[model samples]
Target: MRVSRLSVVVAAVVSAVVVVVGSEGAAVAGAGGAAAGGGGHEVDLAFHGDVTLRAGVVRVRFVPRNHGPSDLADATVRLRWSLPLVGVRRLPVGCLRSGGGGVLCRTGALEAGSLGEPVEIAARVAGRPAEVRVRIGTEWSGGAVDRNPRNNEQSVLALDTGDVYYF
Candidate 1:
């Protein structure tokens, strides 16, 4: 059977799409590459309940879960860990290096059932325990879609502070 020119072009197009779709993101963790399944799985990155509000900092455990069967190459949690205490002269809680919209934490290539890292947000407070709010979700710019949007963002109140934390 003779192949038509149209068939050749169609074949090329299909192959290109396959290659592009197949490599959504390569594992940055060279050692973690073995766990990647290349199935374009979605990740659920969020913070667990009950964060620690101590000192001049608020800390939370960022959990990036792979609800899909396929393993993900990477995951990130962008959050405004803590807002400045009410009436306090301070900006939002800064991550390790607080900047703007929110702080960012990353998990490089989660191996199916893997726990992510702990993200700390430093807040400026004074006197009695300050009341602040922390938010977690996509970064200021953008990020991948959460497998579950309902849990994409979480906010908690940090009240009743003593001399434990400072600016």
Candidate 2:
């Protein structure tokens, strides 16, 4: 059979498109499967911390513990304050400033039955408030399924009286 140049070019283009689309679909499927913990990548992340507010300055110290059968490659812990933060002068190695009243910290590679590096953060609040409500939770669990999430989430109310409030 004789084939025209245009027909040959069209065939090549269709083959390239099919390859691209197929790879994209596979990537999506892989991500979804991992997120669903299809391969039994189950991990439990526990959040434990204390907060202190004194003279418009807030200080926090937290530790993320992993009790699991699978290791966690990476994870993100989120903290949201009731009052707006004016200045954040200090943060742990992997922590970063997030939204106005929020911060996100990375828990790097937590092994099973191990505790991640302890993190401490100090920031100034916008103004003097009677009390501040701090909420801490696991923002990302590195695609691992946590069966018991209760210990990984906490809400603490810290007053301006300069007392340490444990979550």
Best by lDDT: 2
| Each prediction's whole-model lDDT (CA) | 0.50, 0.87
Q: What does candidate 1 score on TM? A: 0.50
Q: 1-167, model 1: which lDDT tens digit per residue?
A: 99999999999999999887666534333223324532334455544545555555554444555454445566555656344333223323333334543556655565555555544444444433455566766542123334466665677666545322211
| Residue 111 shift from truth in candidate 1, angstroms | 2.7
Which candidate achieves the best TM-score against the true structure?
2
Give candidate 2 regions above 4 Å deviation. 1-40
Give, for candidate 1, the lowest lDDT window spanning 10 residues.
86-95
Candidate 2 colliding pairs, count: 0
TM-score for each model: 0.50, 0.76
Candidate 1 — what's its lDDT? 0.50
